[model samples]
Target: MGKLKKIETEIEGVYIIEPTIFGDERGFFFESYNKRDFQEIGILDEFVQDNHSKSRKGVLRGLHFQTEHSQGKLIRVIKGGVLDIAVDLRKDSATFGKSIKVELTEENRRMLYIPKNFAHGFLTITEEAECLYKCNDYYYPEYESGIIWNDSELNIDWELKKYNLKKEDLIFSEKDKRHQSFKEYKKAGGER
Candidate 1:
């Protein structure tokens, strides 16, 4: 098994993982994931799929989760960096409605774990960013759902200045731009 250090986030199920990297002037190497090592740190979920995406700075992609195949993601950046965000939505939990943000970059090699039932998203901070993540369940398009990234109630700081980005500079897909607000998502019982 690999050596991985787990750092707990403020939220109950989320975690920040620091993988042991071996490097020199020749470059570096590290095991991104090892099933046995992950379990030793309490990440028991079995990952069923791997996803990758590339985006430029100012691109904002989500606050989304699936109702049917809700995914718990282990996210990392392979090239460049981003501002990763996750919002707690499990109604019965004490930290419900809370959110956490972590700055992930290729140079840092840190990873964030977003348990199922939470909304997940990221804003690209570098000129270009490539993200890779593992999901615990298969995605079902019919179950795609999200909360608008700027919902006032969530109070996410976003930390746009890290990349000299302004509110007007962020880009979004048409669907992300039209997502439901926090109140609307809750009113529709999406939390349940």
Candidate 2:
């Protein structure tokens, strides 16, 4: 689809996609994803799993990825908005241990494509937001791993206070809160 525009980030393989929108009195229309067009832009991986989640404001879902079955994700917001993030975990990569953040909102209609060997996460910025993503690999619970969202080593600039929320206001699952730090992830051999 000529409707798609791919924006490259500082990190290699990660991209922000802007789909051309046609608006009128009847509202708007845009192609979310077209395999051929996506392949044209280097997003040639085939998506095997589709996942959706809903969360309230101040809720943070991850900094998560699989070790043995690493996934490349194409993520977007279907309702409300979120601050989506991807952290490079490939030890051999020039940008390893670095992260990129982007805002995905229903209004902006932006999407993010995170390559495999990266940890992914997001924070809900609206009262409630629905996030949808396509994964190139299947989910394998046994291979799951994550880095603590607040790891000092990564020091992600979540800007939670800018959204009028304190760190105390953030809701996290027990698993997320207890995840290993980036240092620990590296110490463990950093397998992608």
lDDT of 1 at 161: 75
Candidate 2: pairs in clash: none
lDDT of 1 by residue, 1-192 (tens): 369999998999999999999989999889999999999999999999999999999999998888777899999999999999999989898999999999999999999999999999999999999999999999888899888999999989898875799999999999899899889888988842
Candidate 2, residue 116: the lDDT equals 95
Clashes of each: 0, 0
Q: In model 1, state the lDDT of residue 86.
A: 95
Query: lDDT by residue for model 2 over 1-192, one digit each (tens)?
Result: 346789999999999999988999999988887898898887898999999999999999899999998999999999999999999998889999999999999999999999999999999999999999999999999998899998998989999888888989999999888889998889889742
